[model samples]
Target: MRATSIGAVLSGALVLSASAVTAPAAYAAETGVVIQKVSVNGGKPIVLGTSQTESFTISVTASDDSGISSKLAFLQIKREVGDNYWSYHGTPTCTASSATTSTCKLTFKLDSGWGVPRNTLAGPWKVVVQLQSKDGDLYNNGGDITHPVLRRGKLSVDAGPEPVAKGKSLRVTGKLSRANWDKRTYAGYTNQPVKLQFRKAGTSTYTTVKTVNTNSTGNLSTTVTASADGYWRWSFAGTSTTSAVNAAGDYVDVR
Candidate 1:
């Protein structure tokens, strides 16, 4: 049969192999198989950069009255409302914990430039698990779990005029950027909230001094009164589509 849509493409082209099984319309009610848990990237977001390939792990735990089959499992990470998808291309390593429960894990590698063609594709994505039990019960679902797939963020900080007198204004500058998969480079992440932090010369802690928003070009320039010897840096809390990042501290001395 010819595939027509994104779901169909997954169901037919990549998921219909000899070892793969598509859930029948009534598979849910007739089966005792239960997908107990699903974890992607160890419960953290899958972050990607422009040129380097990022590899992540997916794990599916399922149980049934009968033990799961020995066949390797299949997993698909796909966008909630788009054609973007990343699928496992190798065999999953399945380990049986008991007579009825098994956990299957697979690793998938994604090349940002080749795998992701659109920046809008960043955000929450769902996973589909396909497996069968020894007693013929099937478990294939896409709605039970979701994870964020994001672009890696980059931040730079510069705080200057060394040995400034106390109570004098110090100029702090920075820029926030993130991976652009389509352009295969890094670009500014404009209009995002970033926190300016300071750590005293002898302390191991950093406290927020102020919150500044990146301008049109993701550039940050702010002024603060020098109080003591400390390190200044910019910290981005990040958003749904971008990962959080902190710039290396720029030390300033106050005389």
Candidate 2:
């Protein structure tokens, strides 16, 4: 068959013909799976600080005129960062029972700990989703018979807290905002957890301060009362399990 962009025919209804003659049919060889919608339920862009759990839903519709051949189609998700990769299977958190024809749905919950690396640069992160046929040949003729897939959208990243003054009380705050795929703030501590640490400005020995949680508004603020008066620096560690992004903000003061 001819090669066509999977995203082109993802919407509306589709018809396909089933013939025993092999060697690849046409663009109509298999039923198309359309990703109807993707939503990050509570908040988008979740903030960078403390641990937070966020939920999401992905709606999809599939149909074929050649009859439903594969009933066990599955959805796959991944976070893209250069050559690094993190993948997860979409769980069926919700489903429609009365639906007929080749219909498949999947649900996914990505924790903040599953996000960008602590040293990640400020920019956009990507989440990719794909569908796979369970019991069918993936390759047909010259083209692959893989299920249709799409790059959902991007996640925004920002700096957290860093450079703290020694021997004085320092306040650190941060905000989480969405990007690319509809902005949202995560609910509860389900987002990534924020890690705080300090060290002498010129030294490398780092000490743990405190790891705090962000409020519903994706705001996280904490006071660091130091015991000594020396050049000091602080760092905010990021995780993928919660909604906290890897970031760092620095401050200095003389006491």
TM-score of each: 0.82, 0.31
Best candidate according to lDDT = 1
Q: Write the residue-wise lDDT of candidate 1 on 1-255 in tens digits.
A: 010100000111211121223233455567777767677777667777775466888877777788888563677776634565443334578789999888898887665333654687777666678888898766777444556777788888888778789999999999888888779888888999999999999999999999999999989999999999988988887677777788888888899
Candidate 2 regions off by >4 Å? Answer: 1-49, 66-72, 91-103, 110-255
Model 1, CA-based lDDT: 0.72
RMSD, one per candidate, in order = 10.5, 17.8
lDDT scores for all predictions?
A: 0.72, 0.34
Provide backbone clash counts, one per model. Answer: 0, 43
TM-score of 2: 0.31
Q: CA shift at 178, candidate 1, in angstroms?
A: 0.9
